[model samples]
Target: MYPDYAKKPRNVRLGLCTNDFAPHGQYGRTYSCWPIIITPYNLPPSMCMSSKYMFLTMVIPGLSNPKHLIDVYLEPLIEELLQLWHHGRKACYFDWHRQFLPEHHPYRRNKKAFTKNRIENKVARPRLTGNQPLDRVANISLAVEMPLSLPDGYSSDHKWTKKTIFWDLSYWSTLLIQHNLDVMHIEKNVFDSIFNTIMDIKGKIKDNMNAHRNLKIIWNRPELELDERRPNIMPKVVYTLVKEQKRRVCEWIRGLKFPDGYASNLPRCVDMTELRMHGMKSHDWHVFMQKLIQIAFREMLPEHVWSALTKVSLLLQRICSTTVDVHKFHELENSVSIIMCNLEKIFPPAFIDSIEHLIVHLSYEARVGGPV
Candidate 1:
């Protein structure tokens, strides 16, 4: 409908536009920009649509920041819209980003006060000081205007300057909406953290042996067994692979190939040498959680733990579905909340806090049918 809308003389009104940075690999060294354009709900049902139709207008690779995003990607898009408006073909004028500002003219002048506050504290943290608004673009723009020192490692040349594009109040006042939080990235991180906590994998504080012992106890319970048969062997302690085991596991992962007609987002595993040269991707981690762990550990992981892991995997899978709606997302959130409640004893508050923050936003995004 964008082409058709561009041809129409009526004012164009976009629903919401979301933006986020995505890492190219498991390591966070390199990132890419992703911007999505969503159609307004008021439009005909045929026009407002799915992720497939969501306009992904740019893919700026390397590294970027909010300012870079506004200047490089967003500003160009806005310029095109303004052109359409000037030519009497108004493509969109929703200005979702402006909804969050106070109901007053000349709100941009509030930057001076925030700058003064920053000057006084020297090391004071920066925060949004504007009135509550639906989109945070205004607040973030204001925050950028303050004379906060750049963080270490940022080149002085890259610091904000008087000529920065986002400083143009007229341009910012017409912003489409606040950038979205990438749900996939958030879910993947939360899932990894939860899985690592349970397995007592690298970076988690839990003791692997203790985790194994708890699982063993859970699996060995009298009520859990089938009649007259001893439970299958469970690991008494977490397995630490010797050099030979490491080589074998690496070999197996490298040898893996998807069968014909199997569709996967990630490609088949590369050799260890290639993996070392090129870092792992999020899909590699997904494969690790969904398949590799079971093969590597065999019967070491108890059935109950696998059941719990399955639940987490399924939740991630369900939310990514094109047919997922607000109710389904709410169900996912409730299911995760229950999982967290039951596992609270096993996981730390800090770990649980992180996951809760991501889960809590699902309902809002679901209702809006896009990232909020």
Candidate 2:
């Protein structure tokens, strides 16, 4: 059996993260710097995330993002990583996150929630024990480098962008988690979709005329089928609030208060004139969704709609907790699966896109890779 190298003493498990950001206080400039950061996950959670522990390995001076070409500049760092590949194991990155969830979870039994009529009954195959993945990749030709001589079904059935330079490291395949999900960005997206749809904001709402028509064709709902009476008008659905309800929700938010340093001035972001929220950063949305979302809109929306939103808020709350209970991750996973299934049944198709679906994986990620 393979030992968990990441937990071994004196092991330096490096996390490589890079993104382009506009320099603070230079608001006038349109340019941004692409900076790569290295953090030692070997440190305790309290110290690992601190600025004191983060090391800036390299910075690409940029007026524009180098995109994939950033890899070209990272050659030196890649070489160093190859040399320091201390664990010396070989493996493959698993794509499925749901494999970490309990096998008997009801999320896998629902037909309508995910795909059409088909339930998720198959358990995800476990990762191959040893040299299998390396052998498999050796047969996969990189299409970017050699386009003409690609093997059969390269583009259609299985897509291989390129075996990344990181895979060259001796210990790379030993990691349980290859990439961490950006929880904040995903949280903001879910918040935006739900809030905008319920507010019935013109351009932002997903429960528009088109989605209504699509739903009518797909499912049997007597109340929603009333659009046949007034073909020109998009009949109002229960998910969206009436104008008065929208106004009341906005007014409540406009005067809302929170303890100092608990969250930002959320009241400033609510625009009574437009009846929509604005200027909210990702953190602000995170705080609002996990804490104030269900409470603020409690009586304004229908019982079912409000209940679904509250469940989502609770899921976010538990996942983002300061302390993660490793034993309860299975319970968390089961809850998330059911919550997502309920939301899928309630929200419109556009509202249930990738960001919303990403909720199903958050628990699994936390189980394998703790809080991030």
Candidate 3:
């Protein structure tokens, strides 16, 4: 939002307006010759909002010790977020860069003890932070929502990134492993759940877009053509776009599939659809599985491991951006299994041995529960 090419003063203004700063309580009566005397009316509402928001949002929460908020609130927020979203969590001053508030931006080289710039930014979700560093500013773009819980036996398969890798290793490894396995067992069923959920969401979004498109199209439709029922729905423009998107998704799923020697070779998108025909279970989630997996690998795996990861990442990136194609199934499966094996190598021998044990434990547990 801040204009970049301007002179220092203008840049500062742009940054200040964007940064969170509270309204001045009441300016000093003194008039200084060196500094330009500016009145309160001259200040933007955003600046005032920024300051008050920071004080209320950051300071009041931790009056005991500055670190208390960081430890109790910020730390937990980060940890919980890492668990929930699989991304690194960091907090910074809302607007330290322009006026130089202390620790305004976590990525900054120098930070102060008292200034306010506290914000939690996800390392993986860089867009969420945007160009300006501010806290609690109203944002309408890119709002994310995630399901918090899934069916009794299902779990989210989101990946945790490097930023949270250490945290995950310390606290989430066991729970995450169990969840991952549970998810894999019911993977086919979950696809149906995902597809239906996405379809519903897309349906709504498509409805709105279609409505708007129809209004515009009707307004411009030639007078003679207007009487022909206005075509009930907007012209196929929006529908075509929606179709293209769904087609891409289906193609992506199909592309990722590989041929198996046996009938149950591997679960294709079709299998996922079949499972969906029946009731499917799921959880609410903010993170997409593709991004989550990338974050997890980046956080958990070493550089050497990335060589293999890069290959799969490229495939996944394509799948995420475009759609699924079953024809690519063999490549996808083999690539993923290899990557999984490589990741298995990253853990300590004990961890690996424990996984072996866990496999047995899970098998027994699965049997007790019913089928795998």
Q: Which model scores highest in TM-score?
A: 2
- Per-residue lDDT of model 1, residues 238-276, tens digit only: 223334544565566566677653424233434444222
Better of 2 and 3 by lDDT: 2
Looking at candidate 2, the ten consecutive residues that score lowest on lDDT are 89-98
Best by lDDT: 2
RMSD in Å for all candidates: 23.1, 15.9, 23.1
Provide the overall lDDT of each model, using Cα atoms, as 2-decimal numbers: 0.44, 0.72, 0.30
**Which stretches in model 3 have alpha-carbon errors above 4 Å?**
1-181, 184-194, 197-332, 335-372
Scored by lDDT, model 3 comes in at 0.30
Candidate 3 residues 1-372, lDDT tens each?
434423222112211111122234322433211111112322476753454332222222211323332444344334443443443222222221222212344333222211123232332122222212222221212123222222122224332211222222434432322232553333333232233433333332222322233222222222112234665443332111243444444444344433453122122323333322222123211112333333433433346544443553444344333334444543443344334334232221111222222222232223223333
C-alpha positional error of residue 119 in candidate 2 after TM-score superposition, expressed in Å: 6.1
Give the residue spans of candidate 1 off by over 4 A: 1-141, 148-177, 191-255, 259-278, 286-299, 348-356, 370-372
Task: Estimate TM-scores for all models.
Answer: 0.38, 0.65, 0.18
Kindly report which residue pairs in candidate 1 clash with one another: 12-91, 12-92, 19-180, 100-133, 100-134
